[model samples]
Target chain A: MNKVLITGSEAAALGAKLAKIEVLGYYPITPAFPAMERLSKYIEDGELNCKFIRVESDHSALASVLGGSLAGARSYTVTNSQGLLLMTEVVYHAAGLRQPIVMGVANRALSAPHSRFPEHGDAVSQGATGWIQLFSENNQDVLDNTIQAFRVAEELRTPVMVNYEGYLQSHTLEEVFVPDQGKVDAFLPLKRMPALDVTNPRGVNTVAGPDVYTDYKYIQNAAMEQALELIPKVAADYNREFGANSCGLIEGYMMDDAEHAIVAMGSIVGTARLLVDELRKQGKKIGLVKVKTWRPFPAQAVNQILKNVKYVTVLDKNIVFGVGGALATDIKANLYGQGSMVINGAILGLGGGKCGVKEIKEAVDHTESSENKNRSEWIGL
Target chain B: MAVKNLPIVPSGDPGALVEAANYATWRIFRPVITESAKVNPIVTLYCPDGAITVDESGAEVNYKLCKGCGICAKESEGIQMVPEYTGPKGVF
Candidate 1:
């Protein structure tokens, strides 16, 4: 393994480089700009032989990568908050076309009161676009999951979104062991182009009439469902090669016999884990559940994991405004009528404001004491 | 490219996540806009504190009226609004 002191953005760039990406199509956005900038410098210095396309907008950036993938090139890009939203249209198209493109999303809040801090709103917004969504809880997971995402995407012929908190992971530098190039090359072969034969002129991005539209949509949904099934196998294969396995919808820490659990995603789970350890020493039976994959819902896995718990608190960085926390709603949707008191705490941290270990501990403690059910409370507002 | 005022759904809507997710999912099976579709451009305004507001129709009319608040570019969906740094002949 190659050792490098890298930020989350650089790790993603290095991961893609290891995957032997042939095309880098990107537009700069806060918290995600450094990755693309590094790739650009690499290309300029002849360190990597890749075609880097600088687009005018994020939409064009995604569109260009999709086009590049169709031409049998391994393409990658990075985006965040507004940038992710800007590319929303093509994000869906890329997945629907079953193009095995990989993207890194720096999670941040959507605008109105625009902030550049970390939040799940941006990445979670695209959860239903048929793109496989994976949330990284730390800098290391960011690197590993990003590399694995490409293999999973290629296997399923669907796009994958590897999400990390914007400033938290993107800007924070960490020590990471970069994988060996030769080993990576062996593990991740250059993706073969889909059977696009010039001999047969076939139209892509065609307008389907109503008669075939429904069937096509059904096929897309089936493909996504297939991705959910195939991800674990691919992740397992990855583990065999690297001796590190990090799959599954939710990763539980000290939850085997805990009565109370806290469910969260992205880098905040790291903070929660530390808090869990501190609380454990004080004889508190509290555990933490870090959600790695937010899409394909992972409803069954979540339900099964949290089934025995008496009270569960879900901390969501993004608010749905009128209703409740986004993750909380999803959890409730899946665990409806389960007789568990699940409290949804919408916390304004690292987005609207800075959130640290102290605030996270307070939220967990508050939820542990409250007997509220089906109620959503905003924390640190 | 040009700024315009637009009414936006409040940021506090809890359903925005679900709604945005649904819209994105539907886009996978359908196009964002059908043929001959009419779309109104919304200008995003970015404030100093990172607050964003969408102006659909009636914020400011003149290109010269822009104070470079950046709220429009930061808050607007699907595009980044930045000052035109290049000459008209130069490509972005």
Candidate 2:
């Protein structure tokens, strides 16, 4: 392993290279484009043995990667914002077909209002598309998660999307510890399934008429359920193999004796981590739960961590329009009927808005008070 | 009233008349060649002519009645429509 100063995109590209992916199919889209370039450079330099397929649209990028995956090649793709939305159909197709294609999404806000900033809206909108979603808190996390995503996807036979804030993580440079390719290979299993052949032919994804359509969907869901059990196991194994303690379904900071908890995902969790340190000095019993795995939901791990806390504040970077925040709804659903604990959903940092120390403190302050129990509201709007 | 006796024809003894009628039978419209079934079995259900048939071996196409409409291979995984060879002169 070597220490390198790199952006999230660079880290993501390095992760793909380390994973020994065979096909790198992508179309250029901001924040994510730099990662595409990084991977292309590695391929061009002959350092990484991979086929780089430049496609006309995000749809073709994912489609071609899925095609490559069907041939038993370990494949990957990257996109952000509109590109991710454009490839949404193929994204679902990749998951439904059980293609273990890993995608790196430089999270950005959707268009119509038209802003080029970091937002969880892009990736969060695809929350229920049957893909394993992992968010990163920094450049190192981006690299680590990207490497882990391949294993997670391969084990589950479902596509995995590693999402990080667009400009925040993708453009910002930070110190990252990149593991050796040999180590990554040992940690990740060899390519398996969807093998194409000529000597003996067999049909795959041929058809699912009414007689068996729901059964296929049920199987897909069962795979997702299986993924929940495997995620923490893989993380534990990654930690053991790499001697790094960065992998887990959720990373808790000072939650042992805390009366209140602040829950969030992605880069914002990094900010919350800092705030948790500051609040400790002020004798505030506020802790933090950084959600690393979003799909397979991580409800069991989250519920276990936050069960004893009296008040919980969920900081969501994405909103469900009229339905408050998406992560907030998930936390409420998970924490229901366990205790007399109050859950507050605080929507913050949408469309690249900054989550200041004051905003977090106020959210924490509200959590301690019984005034807005179970309320979902906006912060720093 | 005298009971009217229905004409009873033996299953296989109908011969030339049966063969003539077989030309217009539903079996004629069914697919006998199944190269497309190698890629997608759904083609068996969507074949407008209902000429598609799938077995453990794969799709079998009845080229004699298959009009080569090309719908069987539509949206298929790797199924293709190859040109049929009619052979030399008029050797049926």
Candidate 3:
């Protein structure tokens, strides 16, 4: 295998092509369009053979892919920001029907004021949709996770969303290892749900009345709970087969024996990794917890690592209006009964605002000096 | 085809819960698309119980198979929900 420098969009396209997806559907949106563009080129140049449908809207893109998956085709799609919001209806539909349609999300902030950059709000807002959510820290993680998503989603019979920061990973160029197509195909065989065939027709997305609607949703929830274990098992298999360490649900950097740690996801984790190294050189006990998987919430992993740490700061690029950062809320909830540990919630990088190293250092300083144990601070505001 | 005569709702439920039985006999007026309509009457995706089937001739709704959610009638332009039977003999 050769190492090549490519943007996150290109890596995503290459990953999908390698996975041997039989159908690709998407509507172009900023920061997310580049992946669709590359996939289209792959189809045209005969490098890949797949049914490429450029739908009129994001909703149709998701719906078409959902139908395609039900028809026994390995399907994939991409969307971002408002496009993701538009497709929210089918996002739930795909998950409810257990369609296993893999999607790439160029995670961007939603708009009333209209701004384009990197924010996790687009994907975080869909937390209740019952889709397995995976966040990437860089271009490499974006590609690896996208490839791994199909396997995870198919194994669990649930839809999976692979999210990377818009522009940060989508446009930024980084050196990535291009895995062999044979190995990817070996890892992910052509497996489809038993439905949409005329000869052996099976009903999907059936209407369950009040008597059985709760049971239907209960089964869906049961499948979602499987991801808490299955995601890591799939990652371990990928690591053994490809010899790549890019896939995981959560990654701790220099976390051992640290009193205070910074917790975050997406490309901000990379920045926090660098900051961790810088602080370690000056004999500071600060660490970083990179949350790669957000949907299952990684509750066990988070509680295990942070239980001993005295103070932890959760950095989120997404905020829930009056409620503070969404990730922070989950962390506080998970650590509720774990003892006298302090958790700080900080919201930064809204509407593509840069979460710089300076601001991160200042946040740590504020946490150290302030008497308030549980504080929510807005960085670089 | 022999029609299976069985209760749609279970027997051991509360009366209020069993009220859903009213929907069982409640017939959904299947929309008939005239030849002059120049449109397909098929429901593509939103059929709740896979009630709508489309073939070469056109779209057909199996009322017995339908959940009677009326999603097809509500969402599809060419379909409309009418009473199961307009005559007195169709009373539930």
lDDT leader: 3
- Which residue ranges in model 3 land beyond 4 Å of their true spot? B1-92
Worst 10 residues of 2 chain A by lDDT: A200-209
Q: A19-105, model 1: which lDDT tens digit per residue?
A: 878888988899899888878877888877889988899999999998888777888999999999989999988877778899998
Shift in Å, residue A273, candidate 1? 0.4
- The list of candidate 1 runs beyond 4 A from truth reads A350-352, B1-92
lDDT of 3 by residue, A1-381 (tens): 669999999888888998888899889899899999999988999988899988899999999998888787999998999999999999998887877888999988888888898899999889999899999988889889988999998888888999988899999999999888888889998786744767744445544567666666777777788898999999999889888996577988888899998999989888888888999999999899999999978998999888788888889899888888998889998888886877888889998886988777877777777667665899997
Q: CA lDDT, every prediction?
A: 0.74, 0.82, 0.82
- The TM-scores of all predictions, comma-separated, are 0.78, 0.81, 0.84
lDDT per residue for candidate 2 within A140-189, as digits (tens), equals: 88998998899989887889999988989999999998787788888986
Native interface contacts retained, candidate 2: 0.00
Taking every candidate in turn, the Cα RMSD to the unseen true structure, in Å, is: 15.6, 12.0, 7.0
> What's the CA error at residue A134 for candidate 2, in Å?
0.5
Pairs that collide, model 3: none
Residue A322 shift from truth in candidate 1, angstroms: 1.9
Worst 10 residues of 3 chain A by lDDT: A200-209
